[model samples]
Target: MGLRSFVTDILPTTLHTRGRHAPTLVGEPEVETFAQLVDKLGYLSREDLKQVRAAYKFADEAHLGQFRASGQPYITHPIAVAALVADWKLDAQAVMAALMHDSMEDCGVTKVELIERFGSPTAELVDGLTKLDKLQFSTREEGQAESFRKMLMAMSRDVRVILVKLADRLHNMRTMGAMAAHKRARIARETLDIYAPIAHRLGLNQLYRELQELAFSYVHPWRHAVLHKAITRARGYRRDIVERVRSDVDKAFGEARVKVEVSGREKTVFSIYRKMREKHAGFAQVTDIYGFRVVVQSWQECYLALGVLHQLYHPMPGRFKDYIAIPKPNGYQSLHTTLVNPLGTSVEFQIRTEEMHAIAETGIAAHWLYKVGTKSSANPAEVAQTLGAMWLKSLMDIQRETHDASEFLEHVKIDLVPDSVYVFTPQSKIMALPRGATPLDFAYAIHSRVGDHCVAARINGEPAALRAELKSGDVVEIITNPGSRPSPGWLNIVRTGRARSKIRHYLKNLEHEESQALGEQMLTQALRAEGMALPPESAPEGTSVWPTLLRWSGNRNPSELMLDIGLGRKVAAIVAKRLAQLMQEQGQRPDAVTLTLARYAAGGEEAGATPPSLVVVDGSEGTGVSLATCCRPIPGDEIQGYLGRGEGLVVHTGDCGVARRLSARDKELWIPVAWSEEPVRQFDTDVQVLLRNDKGTLARLAAAVASAEADIHHIDMGDEARGETAELRMRLSVRDRQHLADVLRTLKRSPSVLRASRVKPERPPG
Candidate 1:
């Protein structure tokens, strides 16, 4: 028989009679059994069914004799998942992929083979679904993170990948009863943390709730059982109330001459459990456990029915929300209100149109139901796709900025949270953000450039701190300075992942650039000690010198080598020595007179003895150089530089006890450093004072420090004075050692002070 004739004529008959009425079958009955189920849907063509059958046969053969933990044929699991995808009305490719999703992972089926047989789209879907178990990782979490990252990337590219994967996960979660307790708990937690949130984000509300229910059952079985029993008893007692509310709502709508459908909507067990946990209440205290869903014919009718319901029952104060005007981030729209029933218990009602009801239940899956022409002639599939598109773009944006797999996953998890607050821009455009987001997050949401240059903000026409948390309906305006850059402190205040990633990316790039410049300066000083000039890559004669040096150092490029040197990953003197040798080989001999003078100035260069290169500290080196907090060295403090690995340069006081201990073991990492003629910024150092317990002692100390032109960054005072004296420790920012000495003298002159001195690390015992 022909393909169409077989499907149209024989398939339905065979399905009815369980293959007894079949005329002829082209594949195994097991494959035909599933194909027959899909054929009954009348969604796919005969050609599509043929391809699906081919995939099933191939997968079944690949997983031949394999059984699940429940001892069911492995092929049965794939069949069930494929049936779920078909229920979604996805394309034939998705259905085929669902059937063979585990073939590549469990069986030896190769993507190439699948590609040759079923085509590229189906093969790619299977490949995207496969986990990264075969590869090795240092930790199990790392391996799982990488696998999830790959799947997210794939899903962002093709939404169907996730659709099929969710179906697969749903089936697995359903059959998890046969697995070991520990394994079930682990899978349940993963589903709760990742998969369930993803589903909710995608607008797959039905799948989301089901996954949450299943995961909660596995993660906390005892709680689930207790909660289930409580809900069961509550349902029996509340059955009359539910019916009465339904009847009353029906009559109210009828009297108002509106066409509507009223149905009893009960909260899912998981939702009820969550509410109890969040509110710290028992089951009886959860008044909105039983609700009603009013489906109207039109958006206008939805509002009209809302009025009828309010007149029927007393509406609860501050319990009405109009989401239709401002839909949720996931595109869910409804009018929610709570009312006190006759029994004095709260009853919630969700009022929406038929179309909104569909979206509310199915989310993105509602796209299929709205594909045809509707009253508005707008395709909800496009609307759903648009909603998903915004988040997908964010995923790509975050991926571009973050290269580490675990870090990317972390950012995604932060974004997957469902609570959001809507605020407005100066132009009246509404922007929805995660709850607890600050004005910096708003700026970053506007644009990365805006975020980088943001200096301050004005909320509701009043000046607001940049770290101020934004509330719904606030009109926020970001103040930008053309020269401003992000500060490291912003990372602690910003709440959104996008802002966090952008700030980190900017800081990382800034640090790298600064490090490169410092490394070049250090390398130049080292080369000068060898009586050779550092070669410039742009110059024709010096091009070979850098490449030769990089090859010898196993570095890929000059920038990377410079960055390494600046980050203290490589010693500048060693690279300079090797470069000098290469330059001499090219017939460029060192100037003997200059070499002698340079060596003499550098304290004599010996084999393996790096001459002390005097690097001036001007207090504006950014992250490439820092003063050790333990020593708190300022200018003119007899300072030495320590090149800590990956920590750039750390300046320490020459006699700092901490520095002395480090120098004992890492003697070679030390380099000589000097103060500049002028310093641009003040340095912070610790100061201690012993003061008599007087009412104005702190005020006198503050006045003393200010009179000496020093700023106290922080102050610490212990609780209550012991005997007659109290010790005070404060961090003060000063210009130099002379300024610190001046502050010490001023502090000692105070009547409340018995002694004052710079706080230093205690020395180790001999």
Candidate 2:
């Protein structure tokens, strides 16, 4: 390995713009050179440096004559970015990517050109860093979010993408002062919101602090200036106390014969501002701002140093934390304590080993900075690798289930938040989840199947609702039922992106399948009316037939045409007539016997009722076909289907006035619908249960529903608790009409219930 890993004299800044007659990279007196960048790659072979230098030449040529806001050659910016990547001792491809990240976006250089120049991996990383300027978006924020999502997805596949992107961002931020005031504020806010949090999540403490301080300076310059003055004044007043404490600590450690390095740690202005806002306190109340970090040689010495410090000062109650025993999710390990010093002031201290200090400072970057020659007892690089790679792998899991860029970013942002709760599994295995995460999130984190089939949860072996928020140290056990499926409401309460994505994926697939089935049924009924038989789409003639039908209907594929028919976007009868013509042209003829049978099967036509196709709802149908909210139709209820445009077949209770209104306005869109005898899924229908005003009435009502084996999906009490009685309105999920009857019977049998009846849509609140 090169000696560059131990060198720390280099300065950090981003790429600079190019000038028309600027000095060459190596020839310039002040500009960063090829040698400077190559020197930081102590871990790489000479060939790697050669490839990195070649990339620099390419970027330098492409950015010729371009000048940044700082009036420097544009090539300098990428060179600085590459230099930072080299600081982490990233591979040659990563350095190449950093050098060319902006070439495609700002220099009109293409990804294809980059691939031919520096290979695919470098091109791919540069592509990830490229913004979405080519695509037109309705909003600027939306476009920005999409670009971030794209970058994160690429970063998930290769951790180096983020490493380079972060370096690029750091460089840009360092030179942000050259930009316009408004632009600077916007960039600073973004750095604070997105980049800073990411640095913290990656355990890049030095980068995190710099980004936060830079952002705070521009985001609230007035506040930052005021805090700076206050801190300077406080330092002057506290110098004597601080020095005395340092002296006492040094003397005590010397007596114990323990070799250690101690340094003064000061709180940043942003942290002070945040504390002021969160605690609603004045600056004077932030007593623990004065702190120190003690770096020892070994783990044993960390504990020994902690004991020495506690002996020197009275330790504050409940202010001790042993992170070395159980490291943070980011792989940060240290012993933290607060003590009352001789001056009656509280001072915080952090204790850790030198290796731990390296990991804490550089995070995953430490892997290359301090690579081992052989397998050691405990490797900080391996620890950071396990934790960082685990998080990166999870991004793939989330992306598999979430297709929308915005939604994917949303999930990732939720995961980036470090405020987490540690919950234990039934086996006592601990897992960290973002705070406010419910049992559904826990189930998904454990396994997607567990979340899909989760019916309930038990916290500390006591029955808990699935939506209950998990607390740290809670022993959570999710109960799974193979027959149970995720609920739409789960999306509202689940705190993790993984759970939300999985649920949405399952629902989307379910809806598509149901829509296809419904569309086929409608098209078949339409074909019968056209004096034709429905042909399989997979057949040779059928394949050609659909393309013809889709052409006439302005659809792209067979599934799209069916989905349109299912969603009432197109009249099935009209499409069927066109399809019949196409089939006839293909030399396929309609069968007389099948046509006659289908005509009879087409609902209520003989009795002069609307002769529309029928749709069967067995509760398993996804959102493709839904029971109308206005009607709340269920099994055993005579129903009619309304194919509203973009709304899959909507089943309405036959007597519904909304159905009548829709039929009057759109007669051709009406269809017949029925309920399956043994529907595998459950349907929610509302009911009003009148109960005598008494305690335990809700428990009794729940018991009755449970006894009938029906689940109460949701319930609402009246606006106010009335005098002698109260009405509990419940939306119950029942399997069939018989199941509904059983639930009503059970409710009526309860001693507390005065009356129980199905809630009609037209009924006014009483």
Candidate 3:
């Protein structure tokens, strides 16, 4: 029979029939019994059934001596989980995988063994369900994060991995009473916080509600009992009211020439407690505790039935929602409305077609089994392949940005929060983003590159700050620049994990490049000091010496060694010495003439005289070198480079007291250095400006600097500035000494200026 007829036309077997049905309480039937499992096996071929039985026997043997906390054979749990998968009419492989999911972890069942026996697909599924038991973690939370990361990555590759795992968890929760109270509470909390939400997100609403209720019973037994009794008592007291409302709804639909089936959906204790906590309301204030689900035969009838219910009672303003118009992320579609009954108590109603009801009940799982009657224009495969799988697709994107399993897992959790706001692109395309997302979030959602280069934003055609919080219906346009790069400050404001991870990734790459260049420069300077030259990459011996050098240095490649040098984890001079030793062993010696030229070239004024240890600063060194922030030395300033053990090279102004102190301590490490004729980028230098006190004087100082084409990176005001003269200490980015001099000259032209001079360093970064 076809799926629709099988699902909708066929009625589930009653308990007395002893036939296949939805899961029921234990003792009604053993899940492993031929009748219970074989009944659902009609969809599987004879060979498939045989394969499933073989897996069951293998697991049963592996867990032969094992028992659960309940003192039952461990084999029973896998059987029960398998039964749940069979109920969903999943493929024979899924059923087999469920049977073997725990064997790998509990019985030391190997993937190779499973693959040899049951094939790769089943083995893969089992592997996905297995946790990383062999690895040690710093904390239980860390271990859990890592385990979940593995499971989620597996789920992204194949959805059935999580499906079978959820079933396994459900069975465990069902029998959680057999475990210790503390263990039960912990597992239940995990189920409630992670697994249940995942089920709901997957559209398995049947499992979602049951998991919540089961976890609730274990998490707060007393509360569950109290709420259970309260609901029962309330049910008895309101029986007449409930019957009256149902009777009235039926009659209203009948009179309106509509057909509908109404069933009550009760709130779980946890849900009730959560709603109370979130709304800051008492139990009595919870209006939707006992809501009615109205299932109609067709989409048209669903709306017709909703109208009849609204006509019967006054709808509470703002309580109506048309989910059928825009279904949830999980593809759940329904029309929900809360109305006041004649007795003045609030009553909630949900209206949906039969197919919509099935989808709502099953969620993601509905895509596999819910081929109900033609109430839906789209098939389950189409729905599952598209809307329900959107989150699964996003997992790949998140993985692209984050590599650390724990970090990826954290981002996945953040993405799964369910609540989000819908926004639009400049082209009118719609995108759903987590609430509190910013323009950066929008840019990343559009594309990673867009987010990387984004410099500014425009919301609704008006210029908006990059950090501006995006609202629903806002049309966002991202402005990008080739030169503009992600700033470290963006990490604090960006909302989505994708944006945060990508920005971090870019900055990390940029830092590594800078560090590598610095490392190379430091090594060159170190080799020059040793009266030698860095061996040419194309030196004889028929090839580059870097591979040989890298092998001896225990480095994977040249960049890594350089990065180590740049990061201050390894000293450039030491590496250079070892490299020189290698080259000397290879019959190459330092060119004496070349060494003299390097020394004279590096020395200032007294070129050919007894030369000093000479180093050069070009403002273009990568990560391996840096100019001291304390001294803020620019080109044309008398400078000295300090070979700080493993800190590569740090250049400082020669006259700066901080540099003098450092030189005194590490006198051998200090070397004379000169600036390159032209630098690639702007260098930041401090200028102490003395100005007349005036309201616009500060603005004039800024204007003068801007007119000179200088950018003020930072500004500091002296305490004495509030008196007769203002002392503004500004760090300005300039091309060279000429550029800085021009900026100071411009500031002097203003009548408010008294004197301008470079500020010497007081202290240096540690």
Candidate 4:
């Protein structure tokens, strides 16, 4: 078929549904069989065909009594999926997997059984396509997330897994009309949100557009029908214009002596709908609905054809793009330009070589197509690698860092956006990132180490913020320092799954380490209070302490025990008392002098025994020690520590009402904590200010706080403020009580200040 006829006829509608009255794929008046499927297997060897036929026969027998909602035999779905896979010219194993993809899910066929019949590779491919319905999940969303995670992990290992699964999903989406409205809508939404984007990311434009169209139709039948009618009427109205453009393009290419095939292209219904939604326009206002593709034999002819088209029509200014020099993230290459016709309508033209054309339509699947066709000089493996290797590897990387299925699914969705911006490294190496990606994302894209240690960035040879959005063609230089690590705040600005995962992983590990350290310190103090030293990790000749302690605590290791203590999962004093008892049984006695000193330091408990030493709050501990926001304790304030379950130690003021309420309940979880003599970090405290209503009054108050060497963390003003005075609430970070007092005095001296005082903690009466 001619290129124009191929695109206009076969490409627009690659998937379709058949009503109950319509004929099946095999034909009317005949049962569904492997005859049509076998016809598409010309690229496979005779041996491969025999294996595929065996799989088909086994699947048919397994599904003998099963029928679909449409009353067709269940085996037809597998056959149809296999035929679609074969159409992509995938290998025999992929075809076989497609033929039996549903066996494990529906017919109780196990992976081992398939492995015994087919090879391990074929069985694995089939297994990867199966859903996770056999496993119990708390929610449907969780189950679906895990199933996608499994399939994606398998696809990362072998690309054919996804090819077969996409075919399966495509076939399912095509026949979804037979399902109930709610089920069809749910599946259609999933296909549109996930499968279609994945198909586009893999460069299977043919399947991508078809899946989108079909999903949109099912998801919004009313809108679909109305748009379908509008598109049909528009096609009829513009038939003469399309023919005129085709003739003019052919004549121009002929006169220029460039060998090219010209074809007319129309946007899919989904794409048209998306454009309308994005532009917020009506159907009649949408322009450039029709386009043309010019396929050539070589890259040089592609440029020549572009020149001829630009000369034949008035090229729209700033509407041209050279994708040949910088292909899309999916490895699609073409030169795109919009030109104005004599009727003042805009029409887009895409010029590409035949190989580019194939890749454009089939994407990564074109690798296999080229391997069988001898259509291009490029190696199939290299083409596939270039097109999708990084993205596939990213899936595994994300899985490694993310364990929760829903979180993993969220990361995958973040990566699925098809739009991208291509930037450069300091060495001029090109890196393509999702649009709106920042310098931190670029750093992670280079290496996780780089992202973890990234301190600053320079874009286009000038200093730039790490969170600055990158642009195409900009050279990004990342500066790394050994002391610098990813901040929890970095998650707010990063735009890629890989960067987000890496940052979260780093923060989690850091939190674990800090928690272990805090737990160790607390345990040491508790042991000291008992007049005993913390046991060594292992003894030279005697029994080791950790194994017995871990066994008693039901922890895997000492660090885990410490983590439990640090996170309030276990109490340090209780564990220390138990350890002391175990040591005393082993004939170890406490020193008299140590007991006397500990008892004196602990204020000499009435029972003539030492209590656990007080925990010191220095404000330097990271996530392992946090101040309770309810009381906002500072260094000079009388404080106590509460071990919140699964959360690190929470420091609160001695008189905090929240602390009193909790003390009335689980009092043992609270620990005597004292402020360090010299804390290294500032603490946040709230202050209320009544000021005159004036424009620059707020600014003056801020300057007063800054003059006193305190920083305002946040400010709040009531919207009901009126008349002469306004109430302002501010959270300020100050060194201690003395520094805060200085800030309050400075603020009270201001002329606009009517009143200023520290906001007292709310203490509800019991």
Stretch of 10 with least lDDT, candidate 4: 19-28
* Per-residue C-alpha lDDT of model 3 across residues 1-766, encoded as one tens digit per residue: 1012111121122211111112222223547553577777787888998998898789889989998877887878888888888777778889999988888988888999999999998999999999988789888888888889889878877788888999999888766665667887899888887898888887788788778877777777766666656655666577677777877877787788776677776665667877888999877787666778888888888788878888999999988777776677787889999999998788888989877987887776666676554346665444454654668767777777676777776677667665677778988887878788999988888888898889999999999998888887799999999877777899887887677777877766777787677667667877775667766566673155678888887889777887777665676678888887777777777879867776575663565464444455787664346788877888888888776765667888877778878877867666567787777889998898888887788888888889999999889885552677777788899998888889888988988899998776785455
Best of the candidates, lDDT? 4
Task: Estimate every model's Cα lDDT from 0 to 1.
Answer: 0.82, 0.80, 0.76, 0.84
Q: What is the model-wide C-alpha lDDT for candidate 1?
A: 0.82
For candidate 1, the 10 contiguous residues with the lowest summed lDDT are: 16-25
TM-score of each: 0.88, 0.83, 0.77, 0.90
Clashing pairs in 1: none
RMSD to truth, every model: 7.7, 6.2, 7.4, 3.9
User: Residue 749 deviation, candidate 3, in Å?
Assistant: 14
Misplaced by over 4 Å in model 3 are: 1-36, 39-42, 135-146, 177-193, 212-244, 282-284, 342-344, 372-388, 535-548, 594-766
Order the numbered candidates by TM-score, best leading: 4, 1, 2, 3
Clashes of 1: 0
lDDT tens per residue, model 4, 1-766: 2336423453332233332121112221322569988988998999999999999999999889999998888998999888888888888888889888989999999999999999899999988889999999999999999999999998887888888989888778767667887898899899888999999999999889888877887778767767767877787788788777777777777788887777777787788899999899999998888888888888888888888998999999999989999988788999999999887889999999888998899998988886523456766645575568889889889999998999999999999988899999988898999999999999999999999999999999999998899988899999999989888899998999999999998888888888898888888878878988888766631255567777899999888999988888999999999888787777789878877877776775676754444677787777788899999999889888898988888998988899888888888888888788899889899999999998899889989999999999999997874878889899999999999999999998999998999988769595
| Best TM-score among the predictions, by candidate number | 4
Question: What's the count of clashing pairs in each model shown?
Answer: 0, 11, 11, 1
Error of 4 at 726 (Å): 3.9
